[model samples]
Target: VLDPNSFTGQEFMMWTVAVYGDGWLNFWKELKPAIKTVAPGWSEGWVKFTTNEAPLMVGYATSDLYFDEKSSDKSFIPSEGGYIYIEGASIVAKKEIKDGAKLFIDYILEEKFQRLMAEKNYMLPVTDIKLGDEYNRVPTSTKLVKVKTKDLEKIEEYKKELIKLLKK
Candidate 1:
C-alpha cells in the first residue's frame, strides 16, 4: 500500500448530473482512486482540499489543467477522456440594462476585460491571449502547461489506466 503522507497531489473529477451535478458521492468515487494511486494508505480523512479558496469563483479542474504544483510528478491524465465540468455563477440580470450598464457588460465580453480578469482574478479567460509572465507565475500556471490541440481534445477521455498498472 502507498503511504498517505507520501502522496503529493490529486485531481478528483467529481460530479453528478443529478442535483445540478454537485454530488459528494460522485466526486468521492472519482477522487478516491486518484488519491489512492498517490497514497495507497490514504482514507477519507487523510485528504483535505476543499472549494473555499475562491468560493465566489468556481474553480473546476481539467485533467489537462492540474491544480497542485506538487502533483506534477503524480499527475493523472485519464486514458478514456473526461473533463471536470466547473459550474460558476454568472452576472446576468433579469432584464437587460441600458446605456453605461449595458456598455460595461459589453466591455466585459471584450478582450481587454477578459485579459484583466485573467491577470487580476486568476481565472482563465475564454479569449485567445498568450498568458503573460504575470499570470504564469500563479501556482495554477505551473500545473497548466497547455497541451496541443489534438491532445487537449483528448484530455477529458484519458483514463490513464497506466497509473493502475504502476500500482502493481
Candidate 2:
C-alpha cells in the first residue's frame, strides 16, 4: 500500500468518498483480508501483476501497454471518472546547462514529442493530438473527480485509519 501522504495515495484516499462515502474505515477492513502481499516497491508490484502472481494493483490505465498490447489485462475509468495525476518537470539547480534544459523542455512540449509519449510511453499527452488506434483504445472518462476542501482536512486521519486497518 502506498503512504497516504504520497500524491497518488492522497488522491486515492480522497476517492474513497466517491466509492464508499463515510464507510471508508469499513471498506479498508474488508479489503485488508484480500491483500495477499504488500510490496512497497512499485516495480515489484508491477512484476507480480504482469507475471500473474497478483490479480490487481492500483495503477494508471495507460500502463497496459507496458505488459502487452493485446493482453486481456485492461484498465477502466471509474464511472465517477478518475482522478488525474499531473506530472511536472524541472531542471536540477546545481547542474547548470540552463539553456539546454530549457531547449529540452521546449522540445518535450512539442506535438511531435507528445505523440511519442502517447504511442510509445502509453501516457495521455498533455497536448491535443490524434492518438493511434491502439492508444485510442485505452479507456478514458469524461468526468473527473475533484477532491473537496473537507477531504483535504482529513488526510492525516485517512493515513492513520488506513494504517490501522492494514495493520489489524
Candidate 3:
C-alpha cells in the first residue's frame, strides 16, 4: 500500500497522517531506521504482529475484540492528533451512476446497515449506532487530526516526497 507507483497507494492518501498524525513526515525520518519491516499490506502486518514476529504494527484499535488475544500490544493514539481512518462514500461527477448503485450507497448509509458493518466488518459506522459492548474497551482519542482539504490536492507531490524520504 505504500508503493508510490501504485494507483491505490494509500501512504499519502491516509496512512501517513492517520497513523502518525501531524508532522508525520518529519518524525518518519528518525523512526524509519528502527522499523524492522514494512509489511506489504495490513493483513501481513497484523499477522506478523499477532504471531510475535513483529512487536508493533499498524492496525485497528478495535482489533482486541476481533482477535481476542492477551498480550502487551497496546493501541496508541498519537498525542499529536492521530487521524482516525474512516472510509467515506462519494459518487464521481463524471460517471453516470444508475439507480441501483445509488440505492446501494443509500442503503449502506442507513443506521441498520451501519450497525451491521460495525458488528461484522469491524469498521466504524458513519452515523451513531449502538455497537457491541466490547467496542467500549477500544481506545479512543479526543485529539483527532482534521485533514485539510487543500492538502488533498497535493497528494501526488506528497507521494513523491514520501517515497524520497522512505528511500533515504
Candidate 4:
C-alpha cells in the first residue's frame, strides 16, 4: 500500500513522530544502562557475543542457523515483535545482458536453486521451496512484521536520530 506520491518528506516525518512519540529522543537514554558497550560494527559485536563478553546481541533471526548443528544456542523472535526481511532478485535496468539477468532471476525462483539457497545460506526461500528436517529445528515466529517501503524512505533519518541519541 505504498503510494509513491503520498510518501513525501513531511509524511515520513509525521509517521515517525506518530510511531515513536515525543520521548523518542529518550530511547537510547532508557536503554543505556543495559548496554555494556557498543561495538563499531556487526563483526565486532559477534566477536564480543562469541567470547561471552556480551550474553546477548542484536542480530538476524537466521544467525543461529550458522551454529545450529554445532551449538546448543538458538535465536528466536521475541513475542513483543520482530522484523520480516524479504530478499528479492531483480534484473538490473539498462544492463547490456538483460536477458542473462532475467534468466538468473528465473533460476533463483526455481525449486532446486531455492532449496540450495535455503540450505547453504540458512535463509528462508521466497519461493515455495520445501526445506528439510534440519531447518525444522530453527525457530520461527508468526508475529513478524514487514516495514513499508514508505517507512524505509525515512531510515536514514532514523539512523541519524539513533546516533544522536546514543551520543548523548
Model 4 agreement with the true structure over 27-83: per-residue lDDT tens digits: 446766776766655566678878888877665677776674778677776664465
Residue-pair clashes per prediction, in order, are: 14, 0, 0, 0
TM-score of each: 0.34, 0.76, 0.75, 0.72
**C-alpha RMSD of each candidate structure in angstroms:** 12.8, 3.8, 3.8, 7.3
Instruction: Please write out the lDDT profile of model 1 over residues 1-168, one tens digit for every residue.
Output: 232122211222211122123342444355445442333332322332222221111123221233444443232323433333232434567676567766776777789888886666556777687776544433332222322455435433432432443344
What is the clash count of model 2? Answer: 0
Cα lDDT tens digits for candidate 3, 1-168: 224444324533355655555676776777678766656667776777778787776566676666664655667766655556667777667566788778988999899899888888888788878888878767888886665676666677777777787676
Off by over 4 Å in 2: 1-7, 89-105
Better of 2 and 4 by TM-score: 2
Q: Which whole-number lDDT from 0 to 100 does residue 82 have in model 4?
A: 61
What lDDT is obtained when candidate 1 is compared to the true structure? 0.39
The lDDT of each candidate is 0.39, 0.73, 0.67, 0.62
Count residue pairs with overlapping backbones in model 3.
0
Residue 38's lDDT in candidate 3:
56
Pick by lDDT: 3 or 4, better one: 3
